[model samples]
Target chain A: MITTSALQVRFGDTTALHPLDLDLPGERIYGLLGRNGAGKTTLLSVLAGFRKPSAGAVLFDGAPVFENVRSTSRICLIRDDGMVGDGTDNLRDVLDMAAMLRPAFDSGYAAELLDRFGLTRKQRLGALSRGQRSAFAIVVGLASRAPLTMFDEAHLGMDAANRQLFHDELLRDYLAHPRTFVLSTHLIEEQSPLFEQVLILHEGRLLLQSDLDELRERGVSVTGPAQVVDDFVYGLKVLSERTLGPTKQVTVFGGLDDERRALAGRYALELGPVAVQDLFIHLTGGVP
Target chain B: MRRFPIARFLLSTHLPFLVMVLAGSYLLVAVILGVAVLVSGPASVSAVDVAGQVLHWLAVGYGYGAPALLATVVVHGRTRREFVAQHPVYQLVAAVVLAALITGVYAAEAALYSAAGWTQAMQPDRPFAAGDYPMIFLANVSMLSIALVTGSFAGVAVYRRDGAGALALVPAAGLLVYGGAVHGFFSLPFAQQGLPMAVTLPAVAAGWVLLWACAREVPLGNRVPA
Candidate 1:
């Protein structure tokens, strides 16, 4: 398990991550969802031990992660913007280095991943297209086989087809190996299917964390006559609502009890699940 | 088969450049020696001149290149989010290996010069004599080690600090190297006026300490080099 206590990160006078405690268990895929500047990358960087926290402790399996070689060696943080060094190294060199340093690194697996990604080993990382670089990074991250693997906005320049390819490979490899994976991304709807749990960050603070199944169950939408919907949703947390003449559809932010379902049926109201994306936007006020 | 072998990785990553510098410096010095030998006979190209010139060129090149090499490692390590502090030893190991390789080459060249019956030019204020091969090699190693370590320190200094900060510290570092060189501190094993190992070794240790201190301060974020 990885946990932080009052973990705060500050860059100059600006606090990138406010003090907050967090716990991340093993053998699960965690979707870290946040808008731009919501501190997703900063939080991941701290967890990777890349930067020291300004005010708290980050521990991995009961030991501090910062500067602890044994722990860090077991963790791999892959960022789409860049990885390891200046992107002057050839893909072959990068893989060779990873093969050397990473304990569980599978060279054969890396080779296969490169082929699957349509990336040649001889291509220099600097010369590769943006999408190719992202694929290359994913190849490294997956093949590293580190116990804790985190990818920070790693789909930046990928086309839709490539993005889906990555998601499939990630899930396939993840299920085969069963290691901890944290993916920070803006493509919430596309990636939400793979998440066992979701952590939502808003303005440098953790807004919510819940099981994916549980959170999906929480966002219940009720649609019926405008007067009936208003009466049903009254005194409840209404996340969002849309009105079209006499018809009204309201998305509320909590699960309904059997009694509430009976009441909805009695009023001829329709019930449906609100997509996680809409809930995210409603919670973070991202759309507004 | 070894996991990482960081020191080996450091060495291999840099071997090509080191070899290039060694070959380039050797060719330049060899040409100068060849010209002198052709014009004034082999007797004109003394053992001291050959050894001293080789040391000068090789040391200067390695010294200048050491920081660039270290910056590459340090920055890459940072980007990987690796614990750079624990790995500074890789740079130290690289420096020692570099000193040994260059010194070994210098020794071979000196032996060839000696066999050719070249006169001793007695440059670098250190006069060479029969059976002083060990002392000459030791002196060269010390000089190269000092150069590499100090260069590493300068690199870390520039990496951790901004333009004004790095510039402000350069003069002091320049003075220290100049003062040590002029006073025969660096030519320790061969010169009559040389400082003892007791002092010189500690000086080298101080350089390592400074390098480590500066290395620990290198932020693990992308900072464009100015």
Candidate 2:
């Protein structure tokens, strides 16, 4: 288990991540959704034990993660931004270093991934295309085989086919060796199915945290008479409403039990599933 | 296979340049010994004085070269971060080994210098002995340790704030500060007799402690994912 309590991260005058508590359990892939500066990276860094939290502690297996060699050694964070260095001559050199250093590194898997991506091992990583660099990062990340793995914005540079390949590989690896995988991405709908739980961070605070399926079922859209929709939505969180002609589609992220279903049925109302992405857009005040 | 052999990693980082230190130390001893004999005017500089001068030149090299070398290990960006996470203790071990290698290289030069000719023979009373050789080795090691450790400290400190360009200043700054500080106490006529070890000893001990602290204190921002 990985957990943070009342964690705050600040850089000079800019508040990157405010005091927030989060718990991430094992054996699942988690999707973290956020905007450009929504503190996703800060949260990831603190979890990886690469940065010190200003106020709180991150615990792995009930032990503080910061500088805990055992915990940190089991955590692998592959940053999607410009974290790779430039001066190297070729991929072979970097791979050689990896072979020497990363204890659990899989050379065969690395080579296979390189071949699958059509990357020449002789080519210097610095000279590779942006897509290839992300691929290389993926290879290293997966091969590291740490107990906890986090990939931040790793989808941006990947093309449709490459992203699909990554997801397939990620699932395959996870099933083969069950571990915790947390990924942050802006492209939600395409990747939502992979997530066991979805977390959305807005600005510096966590706006939502729920299982993917639970969040999908959290709200229902009902269409009927305005009075009926209003009556049905009573005591529920009515997220939004729209009326065209005599039909009404009032969406609310509240439960619809047997009584509510009977009421909707009596009013000849139709209930529809709320898409996670659309609901997220509504929650974050993004027009959809 | 070895579970991240930090010693081997350190060797890989510093070994290539250590060859340079060996060659440089030998040539340095020859040049300084010859110059001391020629310039102190045939009248008096002793073998001990020539050895001290040669050791000082080696210290100069450490001050100038060690920072540049250390900067390479001090984490510039992605590659460095990976290097640090994988090879965690390599730089600290490299600093110590580099200091030791430099001292050994200089000590070997002292043997060559003795065979070629002592700048000033110990005369009718004191002759160089097997025990004295170890003292000479210890003194040279202390000097090199002082230079390299101090260089490592300044290198890591300034490198993180900026990049390679910032570290470029460390070599020049370290040499000046250390060079001046070493020659400071010797200016007093009463302490001139006790100056050589006095200058190198505290500086070496202090620099070792400082670099060790630096290895622990080095921080690369927001690297681990939260």
Candidate 3:
């Protein structure tokens, strides 16, 4: 288990992460969703021991993580820049170093992933394209087999096909290995399916943490006549609305109770599920 | 002492590069000295004297390379404590190897000068006699090791404190000044009084201690900008 008590991170005058308390139980995939400058990267850096907290404690399996070799050995965090190797170093050298340092590193698995990603061992890290670099980072993250692995915006430049491959490989590996995986990404809709739980961050504070289905259930899209729709959702939290001729559709933030559902039924209103992406947008502060 | 894997890894990676650079430097010095002999009818200074500059610069380069290696090892799950502990071992071994190679260059130069019937004279301020190979090795080891450690201290200072790190050059210069002064002391008649070791050893020890203090708690930033 990973736990933080009043964990805070500061950069000069800016408080990147406010005092936060969180408990992340092991062996599950967690999707960390946050807007730009929402402190997702800061949180991950602290978790990975890359940055020391300004205040508070971060413990993994009841042990302090910062500068602790035993705890760090079980954790791996891959940032957007693929911090695995220096630019001048060859890809093979990076893998060799990983093999030496990372106890659970699987060289054969790494080699297989390298081939699948169309990356060669002889290529210098600097020479790889942005997309290829992301691919390479994914390869390392997977092959390290760390008990806790986190990737922060690690798939930013990957193409659609490659992203799909990454997702497929991640799911396949998680089933076989069953370790904790925290992925911080902007591709919410495409990646949400892989998340068993979701953590939403807004303005350096955690907005919410819930199961994927439960979070999605909070949003409901109601469609009916324009006058009737407004009357039905008048006192409720309305996320967004769209109109087409005489018909109106409004997305509401809260789940409708049985009483409210009966009322909607009497008014001939049709209620449907809202996409997770739409809920994220509305919950994070509707429209930019 | 327990086996330090990180230190061993550093030595394995860096030593080959040092050897390659040393070979190239020796070849370059040999070519220059051969040309000087052909043109001026046997130069007074030995090839090792001209080639010695490479060891100093290489020591500085070795020290400057610390930040990159620090990043690599830290990201690979090694602690700063592990790195700082093993790093001096790496530096010591490298310095000793380099010093021995340089001493060999002196021996080879002596033989070549004797074979060609050329008198091999050294600079007046040099700590050792022209034919004293052991003192030559000891002096080079001290100078080169100090240079390397100073370079490492400055490198980490800059790494942790970006723009303000430039101020480290002040202390770096101080360390080098002491390193040079100790060599001059070695040439003095009172060298056996242990004064040079007293002054120089503390400065070198202080450099290593300062490097550990600065690096142990430094927050690692992304080496490649996002």
Candidate 4:
């Protein structure tokens, strides 16, 4: 398990991440959702011990992680731009180096992932296309088999088909070996199904942390005559609204209890589950 | 084994390459000089001393190679953190290893010169006969160690200061003054192998300490304070 207590990151006067606390249980998949500059990457870096926090501590199993060989060796952070190797390094060299450095690394599995990604072992990573680089990074992250692995916008360069392939490979690998995985991505709708829990960040502060299903359940949209919709959403939390002629649709917080459902039925109004993407946009002020 | 992975990685990866390049370049120069002497005769090659040429090249190699190697490993994503974690001790070990390698190469060059019956024109004023090679090797190794450590210090200064022009000039100016002193001092008729060690070892120790200070607060990705 990883626990962060009052962690903060600041670059000069600009606060990248405000003081925040988080506890990540092991053997689970966490989806870290945020728009641009939402402190997702900063938080992940701090956890991985790649960047030191300005204040507070990040502990793994009750011990500090930064500069601790025992802790950092078990954590892996894969960035999207491929930060690990130089241009002259081939996939084979990279895998060999990883095997030597990462205690839990599996060479056979790494070879399998190389083949699955259609990357030749002898090919230089610098020569690969952007999508190929992303695939190679994903392969390294999965193959390292670190107990705590974090991926920060790791699939932004991949195409749709490759992205799907990555998701499939990730799920398959996680089922095979249970570990902590924190995936920070903006593709909320496409990846939310794989998340057991979700953490939302807005403007350098955490907005919410809840179960995936519970977060979705918290949003409900009511559509009906303009006056009825306005009256029903009144005295409740309204996220967004749209109007057409005499009709209105308002997305709001709080699940509809049976009484409100019956009231909707009596008013001849339509109710629907809010899309996770729409809910994210509403919460983050349409940053994405 | 796990305690000093930075030192191990650097020794495994960078040292071998540097050694190969140094030895190969020296041998190539030696072979070319041998061929030219054979073609033109010993009198024509009177001014061209192969042993002195090799020492000159070795000096150049350590002065530049040490800094480049450190910069490359420190910026690399895989090795940077470990490099920082195991710092001053790693550099001390690196200095000794690099010096030993250069000394070994010089020994091989001397043996090859003796077997080939090549004339060593620029004889030292010190007691440096074939039997006294160890003393001569120690003297040369001390100078090279000083050069390498100084270069490593300048490299970290440049890294911490974000490649500022002033810090980049540190290595160039240092090398110039040191090289000038080596030339001027050794040109004296009474110079011996013992004096250079006195100057070189203290400079090396100071340089190592400065390098540690320069590297203490360096963040990942070589970021400077805003």
DockQ per candidate:
0.19, 0.08, 0.45, 0.19
Ranking by DockQ: 3, 4, 1, 2
What lDDT score is found at residue A22 in candidate 4? 89
Local accuracy by lDDT, each model: 0.70, 0.64, 0.84, 0.69
| lDDT of each residue in A97-210, candidate 1, tens digit only | 777666688889989989988889888877888788788888888887888989988877888988898899899998899999999988888999999999999889999999
lDDT (tens digit, per residue) of candidate 2 on A174-270: 9998999999988887888899999999888999999988888987989888877887788887777889987788888867899889878888999
Please tell me how candidate 1 rates in CAPRI terms.
incorrect
Q: Alpha carbon lDDT of residue A108, candidate 4?
A: 96
Which stretches of candidate 4 lie above 4 Å from their native place?
A: A221-254, A259-273, B1-3, B30-118, B122-132, B161-200, B222-226
TM-scores vs. true structure, each candidate: 0.77, 0.66, 0.90, 0.78
lDDT of 4 by residue, A123-239 (tens): 997788877887888888888788888888788677898889888988999999999899998888888888999999877898998888888898898999999999988888788
lDDT of 3 by residue, A74-185 (tens): 8989888875887888999889878877788889999999999889999999888888989998999999999999999999789999999999999999999999999999
Candidate 4 lDDT, B35-93, residue by residue in tens:
87689754222122334434544544454433333333322223444654454454446
Q: What is the number of backbone collisions in each predicted candidate, taken in the order shown?
A: 0, 9, 0, 0
Best by TM-score: 3
**Highest-scoring model, lDDT:** 3
Query: What digit string (tens of lDDT, one per residue) describes model 3 on residues B1-226?
Result: 1257677676777687787788788989899888987898877877777557555666777788788788777777777888888887788788789878888888888999999888778656667778888778877777777878888888888889755377777888788766655554224453333344465567779789878877888788765544
Candidate achieving the largest DockQ:
3
Which prediction has more favorable lDDT, 3 or 4? 3
Candidate 1 to native Cα RMSD, angstroms: 5.5
Instruction: State the lDDT at B120 in candidate 4.
Output: 46
